[model samples]
Target: MTELLYLFDDSTECTASVLSCLPTGDGLYAVTLDRTIFHPQGGGQPSDIGTINNVSVVKVVHTPEAVLHLTDHEVAGEVVLKVNSEKRFLHSRLHSAGHIIGLVGDQLSWHATRGNHFPGEARVIFEPQDPASVKLVDCVQFQAQVNQIVTQAFARVLTENNGIRTVTWGNLPAYPCGGTHVKTLNEIGQVEIKKIKLKKGQITVSYALT
Candidate 1:
């Protein structure tokens, strides 16, 4: 297994040794490294795109055995692994925004059932205690509350026990997650709750960064 450098370091670039490089069809190669800063596509966040020795890394995936970097060209020996910083920053901001929205949902007595932090498709789905009680006005109020918290720029606290990582901000409920996030809520910038929709028993709150 590859050591995930991003877990411990904030830097988006790192030097690593190529452990194995194998062909996986379609003119692509599955490259493994001793350590990597590239975040694999998981937990609803997309993979980081950057270069390995100037070779484009098309995709990244985590397996039980190792973290694979899919590239168009083969690479070996020592390589400089770099992530597209712009994309990384956007992903972090959007993911942190989702968490804040989840906190707001808790305050409304709604339970978060799912979330997607992908840029342009970010949303949090919740199951309200009383589905009929949810309304657009309530969503607007919730958005205001979330923006207030973001303005406060609460620090994000991360802790792990028994291999389960929990993230918390101020008095908000701690949530178990493996995705990347900003160090503080203020980095999420202006959060706009685009819309709210009720489908069956699920209340979906769509959001965007302004």
Candidate 2:
């Protein structure tokens, strides 16, 4: 397993040793690092795209064995891995915003089943529950509620224990996750609750950044 540097450190650039570089044809190679700062596509987030020693890293994926970085060149030796800061910041915002929505869902007794933090498609899916026992909130009220939750400073807590990683925001519930996130709730800025809908016993909270 590759040492995931992004978990503990949010730095965009790091130096890594190229473990193996296998050609995947069309002048592309699948490179694996001894450790990496790149976040693989998983946990409702997309892969981090950047450059490895000037070689373009188009995509990153987590195999059962290691994190494979698809690059345009066959690299070797120690090289610098530079994660795209613009895309990373956007992804962090999307992910943190989604988690905040999940936090609100928990307050409403609507635990999140899953979430997608991709840009323009960010939404939280809640488990199906008894409608009679549920209290619904409208989009406007939901946004207000989110504002109430996020306006205060909420320091992010990322912890790893026994190979398991969890993230928490202030007094909110800690969630098992592996994706990247904002360092603080204030970094998430204004969250826009696009819509809140409950249908067929399931609930969906659609959100975006303002």
Candidate 3:
């Protein structure tokens, strides 16, 4: 099994020396490294896309023993894996945004029935029994307040206790998650809520960063 560097330390970025690489049966290159920072797609989030020695990494897939990097070309020599910083950053931001919506909405007694970070567009669907109590305007206002919390640049703490990785959003929300996230709430910035619908004891809240 490969040691997941990102799990222990999400801040680490590079691995200086890499060992042998092999093509696994699942159409993915099993690149063994002394260390890595790539966060594989798991826990309801998509994988990271970048390059290994300048060759584009098409996708990062999870395996029982190792995280595979499916690259654009067959790699050789002492390989170097580079995760797309922009994509990683954006995904991180969006993931935390989803968590914020989940935490705050839960605090307000609005339970999230389904929540997802859909690459470019992330959303959290809530289920509130009395839909009339929370208006669309209320969602907008709630988003405004979320941005305020984001602006504070709160610190992030990651921990694994009892076999579950927890992503803690500052001081408010502490929940188990395996997805990548920004180190601070300020990175989330201003967000927009949309697609408010009330049906069958549910209130859906969709989100986008503005």
Candidate 4:
């Protein structure tokens, strides 16, 4: 099993021993390391791209067995691992913003059904207990409330129980998650609600970072 270094601390770079380097078809190689600071693609967040022994990492994926680092070239022995700091910061901001949006949905009596934190496509889908109860005007109010909460700059906290990780912000409701996040909500910058759509029994809120 590969040790996920990012879960414990926010180290941007580390040197890890290469366990195996296998060709996964095409010209790509799947490199496995003893440990990694890379955050694999999961939990609605995209994989982190960086370098492994100077070879560019195209993607990172977590399997039941281990974490696989996809690279264009092969690597061996002790490799220097580094995560792209800019991409990591953007991803963390987008992901943490999504969680804040989820909390807002809870305040509206809606449960978050799904979410996407991919840069330009970031959004959260909520399922209201009663779809008819929400109105178009309510969406505007929701956006205002979320922005007020963001301005509060609540500190993001994380804890683990029985191997399950949970994320909570200030007095907001806590939720299970395994994604990277900023230390505080203010780091998320300004959140703009791009659009809101309510259909069937679901409400989709699309947002962007300013």
In lDDT terms, which candidate is top? 2
| TM-score computed on alpha carbons, candidate 4 | 0.94
Position 75, candidate 3: lDDT:
72
Answer with 2 or 4, whichever has the higher lDDT: 2
lDDT of 4: 0.87
> Which of the predicted structures, 1 or 4, would earn the higher lDDT when compared with the native?
4
TM-score of 2: 0.93
The parts of candidate 3 lying over 4 Å away from their true place are 16-34, 76-78, 128-137
Worst ten-residue run, lDDT, model 3?
A: 11-20
- Give the per-residue lDDT of model 4 (tens digit) for 36-138: 9999999889989999988999999999888999999999999899999999999999998898888888877887889999999999998885766764426
Residue-wise C-alpha lDDT for candidate 3, range 1-210, written one tens digit per residue: 556777766653565345556776676666655566788887656788877788777877787876777765667666666778888888888888888888767767687766778765577878763566763327667777677677777888888899788887567768888888888788888878766666666666778887
Give Cα-based local distance difference scores for all models.
0.86, 0.88, 0.73, 0.87
**Residue pairs of candidate 2 with colliding backbone atoms:** none
For model 3, which pairs clash?
A: none
Give the distance in Å from residue 101's predicted Cα in candidate 2 to where it truly belongs.
0.3
lDDT per residue for candidate 2 within 1-210, as digits (tens), equals 689999889999999999999998777899999999999999899889999999999999999988999998889999999999999999998998888888777777777888899999999998744556876767787788787877768899988889899998887888889999888888888999988888877788988988
Stretches of candidate 4 exceeding 4 Å from the true structure: 131-137
Residue 129 of model 3, lDDT score: 38
- Candidate 3 global CA lDDT score: 0.73
Model 1 lDDT per residue over 33-103, tens place: 99999988887788888999999999999998889999999999999988999999999899888988988
> What is the RMSD, in Å, between candidate 4 and the native fold over all Cα?
1.5
Error of 3 at 147 (Å): 2.0
